[model samples]
Target: MVPVDTLHDITARTFASDNYAGVHPEVLAALAAANGGHQRAYGADVYTARLQEVLQGHFGPTAVGYPVFNGTGANVLALQTMLPRWGAVICADTAHINTDENAAPERVGGIKLLTVPTADGKLTPELIDRQAHGFGDQHRAQPGVVSITQSTEVGTLYTPAEIAAITAHAHGLGLRVHVDGSRLANAAAALDLPMRAFTTDVGVDVISLGGTKNGALFGEIVVVLDPGATPGIEFQRKVDMQLASKMRFVSAQLLALFEGDLWLRSAQHANAMAARLSTGVAAIPGVRITQPTQANGVFAALPLGVADRLREQAAFFYDWNRATGEVRWMCAFDTTEQDVDEFIAAVARAI
Candidate 1:
């Protein structure tokens, strides 16, 4: 193993993504608290048990939490549970699973993803119907699941009513609904709604409930909302290789996140910072805010060469659309007002 002293500096931070931020202090403390215990491995520990209770408190009494290592694994495993050998999922083209997962759903899970182009990374019933009609056709992969992202990739949100409408439509078409809730907390904070409002109560069959994006060091949970709709997820999780052997650490971190609204507090702070960043950047003459600043991300299209000049100053971010010069700036749990101010100033200077 590499020497710890040779690692990247712990003090370094960035706005490239929330994944760049370090662990939340409270989540770290919980990990330390769960470090030295002889607990059963693989989801049988006290912490994992308590996490179920905590998750149920948010998702409903029947909600079940299955902790996985990262968002990709959670999405893959959860989607697998909702499909069969010949099943396909309908999702927005901009979905993380479609754009980011590198085809793991098809490669690893043998599941096909039927994608639709969405304006703001959200899929409506009209969009769902575009791909939902090929059932019982042996030549075509059956559409069995509809997966949606909350607080979407373009930093837009799905109001609870919007999600409810999609879920209702999906079920009517014999499709079970899955939420790739990698940023569910931000959507909840933005809408000021309980998690269940857009999830269980809205007929979401399963959710890849995220933690790493919000504040945990690294973990996401597959919340089984309607167990009847999802069969054999326990086995699917193992087959996907997402089962954490030392699960208490993962469970403890999530438990701490939900202990007293720490999830909401962290998400709200990040969202606030993004709103501030968007407001400041919009004032710059050459920078155009591309999408609404709905959560903790800002999508902007800058004048040609402006993004490269900004990168020279070590302001980290990525180009969302290379052809259009659109960039994505993300905020994290620890992002501060000062950070936003400095970034806005840097953008002004670069432009």
Candidate 2:
């Protein structure tokens, strides 16, 4: 299978999302390497087996990986496995599953999502208590799980201790803990901590291990840490339509991420790029950096009409809060220092 390189314009890039970046060369190379062989279907392939082992090494021996198609699929499958028919999830109002997933969890998974407004997207035990009431109240959906995002949707990170506290609090309330780790790699990179420090060792029950946002072409996995806390995910994934029939490719991409320090290297580079972007743009007058630039995203409130003017130059960014004119700039593994410099200059000129 000769690799196809010219299928798309390689020069096309954007700061709209990490999703906009092309697959990492290493990840694509791994994908090409996994081709040309007749592997078993539906996750019965050798690559899938290898992925499980690789994930276990990072997450712990008790951890298991079930590669799925995308982040939404992983979240819905994981949250469903952690909940019952009348169960509900407690998360920050900014959670991707709550705001971005188009209600897939409620519509398809049949679980209610109880959201709490967060200043920086990180949930605490106090916030969880706000929605952690009414257990066994048949009329109200029970709060069964606390779903927290690592390097949360707003790109802020939770320290290992913060995660441990939240997990302990949730467990004491008889609710399992689920981490929507869509940017887990970024959090690990920013904190310079091992993945386990904030996950398995800290009492997290299940993880929606992300791959696409990091570097994989397209794949995410549901990693069960405390198996006793989650069951029937194997069937849950199938019922949710997240079970990839040709799962070897998905497994192969994920394996490439966890193969060596590829995940860390990519995430660190992205985070550094965001830091550089934040530093350069903050010096510009009228550009207020809103959220802490902790991970690979920089949130700022641009001067009136300045965002639109800058859009004319790059045309790829999100208005995080339209009412407040706050915008979000994302950096990816392939995002360069030159991109940051140009974007900062563009902002300065626009202002």
Q: Estimate each model's TM-score.
A: 0.97, 0.97
List model 2 lDDT by residue over 73-105, tens digit each.
Answer: 999999998888889999999999999999999
Error of 1 at 139 (Å): 0.5
Give the per-residue lDDT of model 1 (tens digit) for 259-342: 679999999999999999999999989889999999999999999888888888857789998789999999999999998999
- The per-model lDDT (C-alpha) reads 0.91, 0.92
Give the count of colliding residue pairs in each prediction. Answer: 0, 0
Model 2 Cα displacement at 115 (Å)? Answer: 0.6
Instruction: Give me the runs in candidate 2 sitting further than 4 Å from their true place.
Output: 1-7
Q: Cα miss at 149, model 1 (Å)? A: 0.3
Instruction: Pick the lDDT winner.
Output: 2
The alpha-carbon RMSD values of the candidates against the true structure, listed in the order shown, are 1.7, 2.5
